[model samples]
Target: MKNNPVNTDLPLFCPREGCVCYQSYDNKITKDGIYITKSDMVPRQMFYCHGGGHRFSETGYSELFGKHGSFKEYEQAAKLSTYGISANATADVLGRDVRTVEQWQKALGSKGQQLHYFLCLHIGINVLFLQMDELWSYFKNKSRQLWVFIALESETKFWVSFELGSRTICTACRLVKGLRRLGKWGDDHILKVTTDKSAAYKNALANIMGDIQYAYLQIVKRRVKRRLVTVKKFFVKGMAEDFSEKLRTPPLLRD
Candidate 1:
């Protein structure tokens, strides 16, 4: 058996659940051997975790683990999905079965959720300006209405938080509360929030961030025949001068 060399750049951990050293950085992990799958014809490294008394592949604890198909195909499918392509359409384009595409979507979505939680959630971010809005969507039919509430940082264009549910106060509260948890405010920092004129948002902000020093702006748009005719801005909280100074010169444009 040819013993494969372990990559030092990547941390090795025992992925076995319930093991004492599970997910811990341990030196007991050693490269065991290499195996090539018939589908990809690529040599994959395997490792032995002496602490867990088990052997696993390098792809363990990752989306690629136990996947028999080419990584490129999976990536292409995910990219197509992000581009608003339906799974059935992606299957036809990739010459794959619809079920296979759906399975890949589920696996990729799970991995994406895990990554988002680790990278975004529970992390403190100093947000100077934020934009909050809800997009209308539906599931299967129009009768089943769904809303996607999203909060984004204006300067970095970073997606701060999101919630999916009905367009109601409960969903709005969840979104605002999530922002309150992730946001780190200083003594002089004043968060500026812009959103469409929605009563739910106003109430949710009052309930979640009442004590926090923040400026809230509501933009009410009047549409004639589905075309925007006019837009009116209203400051629901904080001084108008504060928002005027921040809006006039965004962080990116300032020295």
Candidate 2:
């Protein structure tokens, strides 16, 4: 791939932030498709220089650089589909073919699934609440089911995590693994993780976080009520307004 001309006066750096090359703090060039860090760790050229840690790219870089269009679009498309919008619907909004959308979705794979799940999980994690439930449904009579456990931060009303399962400990472990992979587990960042007194989550947290912190909330009506209320009051209602009309509504409201 042809690279855009590098700005020598400013100098380009590695793309990865935590990479040893960026940490070198020197004028490094791509040599033999490798970037030699200060410690002499040879990382690939692609990982070099994270657009200099500001905008992630300079003006005209989009047209002048990168292998493809923005990954942000793909992230948005995945979120839409995961949150109940069909892939075709996302394709329409993104101005891409349905198959292309599916291709992006596939390209994202587990990482994409984790990213979309973050929105769901973050909503529950920050709220100081726990709710567990087993939901059952059938698509063409083929039992499509889910076991969902949520850890909520009641104070901020944000999600800690949404651990989804196929009603098994193995899947629960997978959810925990996903959280760890996302760098959420075993971190002091989360204040309190709560879930319905499930041994699986409790055990998983214990294993990962070393008895860090948690609360066990019973499956109660008001917990869910509060969640629904938060969602409707914040996300749903906020998104429901027609921005075009709302921008025009202040004069009407005053009248």
Candidate 3:
């Protein structure tokens, strides 16, 4: 197949933060030329920012910037890494050095974090029901225990917030505070929360969500030798009968 000509319809802007037209939609950017790299043998489009007197490529501010490899190769490595494949195994599958895969993974992870913050931070959403939980993990060795506290919106199953720390009330408070910042609820709207039988969550919700009208439930599970015996539920804040009625006919399902 023949190489396609550059499309001028793309929304290009000055990426330099100090530039006058940074992120502006004005017609201050123009195509400079095309450059071909040996690694991918593909032509990359370059542009000039007249407002900032800066020059950059199409891949500027991206994870693939200044990377010497095919885009498909980097994408495949990221996909494999997400599937729990080790960097060494990914290098063997792609016929590349393990160090290169590791570098790509780090770069991709940084870019992912930036994107996630840009999209999720302070962007409030309507959350009626939320569930809080924690997962135990370790770093380097089993002795160094770590916990991941997570809050999920029950109806949409969207991850509202998370914190990495010890399984303490401090971490739980941070998680709930983040949820408060990201959720939009009115005084009349009663936010329902469910969590395991952890006193930390109880204190956190009570402290951080005191002003908001909400219902809290704790699920207690009895286990003998890792085998479940009985399960019980307790309401800590709102009335149990009201909470159960709301659960049976959730706000989203109401006519």
Across residues 1-255, which tens digit of lDDT does each residue of candidate 1 receive? 023553336477788777888988864899999988765666778999888788888677776676656677888988998898999999999888898888888888888776665545433356788878888888879999899888888766678788999999999999999877765743478888888889999999889888888888887777687666776889898767767764732222111
Per-prediction TM-score: 0.81, 0.43, 0.75
Clashes of 1: 0
lDDT of 2 by residue, 84-195 (tens): 7877888889887888777666665555455456454432222222222334434435666555544333434334445665656665566665554433432443233333
**Clash tally for model 2:** 25
Q: Enumerate residue pairs that collide in model 3.
A: none
- State in Å the error of residue 2, model 1: 45
Per-residue accuracy of model 3 over 123-230 as CA lDDT, tens digit each: 335677787888887877999999989887776657778899998999999999877776465456788888888999999988988887888888666668766677
Winner of 2 and 3 under lDDT: 3
When summed lDDT is taken over every stretch of 10 residues in candidate 1, the lowest stretch is 246-255
User: Which residue pairs in candidate 1 collide?
Assistant: none
Stretches off by above 4 angstroms in model 3 are: 1-13, 24-36, 41-45, 121-124, 185-188, 222-229, 241-255
Which consecutive 10 residues in model 2 have the weakest lDDT in total?
Answer: 246-255
